[model samples]
Target: MSTTQNSGRWPHEAPPAGQDRWSWRPQLLSELPLIRRELRRSLVADTSDAAAEQEEELHERLVLLMDELLSNALRHGRAPVAGLVRRTASSWLLVVSDAAATVPPHPDPDRDPARGGLGLRMVADLTTAYGWCSDGGRKHVWAVLAPA
Candidate 1:
């Protein structure tokens, strides 16, 4: 596997230090629904004092972002895929890691939406900050969303 820390055009950074973190392993695509449910539950439990609608929207965005990154790892990266959610004072960080250190995220700006590779682009646009890094033979892709 390639040892390149951050192989793509995006910046490289580790998951931010936070108040709490949750981690899980996701090896199959079929587990997405369960993952989403658990993520929502966790968000609701550890959530802030934000307005109800805003909190719901944040949960939705986090779930969708996790789905995209975790699905990509399951479909293309080598197992076992790891997922993490970290809640900091100002943001929530979502990270997914796999054994495919040689294969970093590829975001094609010119790709057609119907071709279905636009998730990462949407993620980049939606998040406050996002990037990936390879460490200890695992490639980690992470995104940070404001808690608001």
Candidate 2:
């Protein structure tokens, strides 16, 4: 029940999204709900049945991935945190960027999962691929999402 229209491709398949994809520069944590809503609307506007389920599933995964990345960037990394979702014929790319460049992103499976520290692990399992790198003064943690 979303009004957003996909440029021909079912939200799940995500038509060729040129050079830059959906991008966001969230100023406060309070803006996350709005951002999530917009993303969900755009990706699930016209899906149905199995495809709908798949799109919904992928959308949920991306939400969690984005949440973890953004929160981590704000809590641990530096300022100017940004997020983007890119799509091609067969895959979706979720990227989170921040000014922090010293500490690299690591998923410590052995860490306790109660309070926290398990977000990255979840990202690894939920996404088709996951990695992070630092460029200039920015660090980007990216995940590849696809149906299993």
Residues forming the 10-long window of minimal summed lDDT in candidate 2: 1-10
Query: TM-scores for all candidates?
Result: 0.86, 0.78
The C-alpha RMSD of each candidate to the native structure, in angstroms, is 4.6, 10.3
Residue 50, candidate 1: Cα error in Å is 6.9
Tens digit of per-residue lDDT, candidate 1, span 87-131:
878888888999998787887777888998777888887788888
Instruction: For model 1, state the Cα shift of residue 83 in Å.
Output: 0.5
Candidate 2: pairs in clash: none
Q: Candidate 1: which stretches are off by over 4 Å? A: 1-8, 48-51
Index of the highest-TM-score prediction: 1
- Top lDDT: which candidate number? 1
lDDT of 2: 0.69
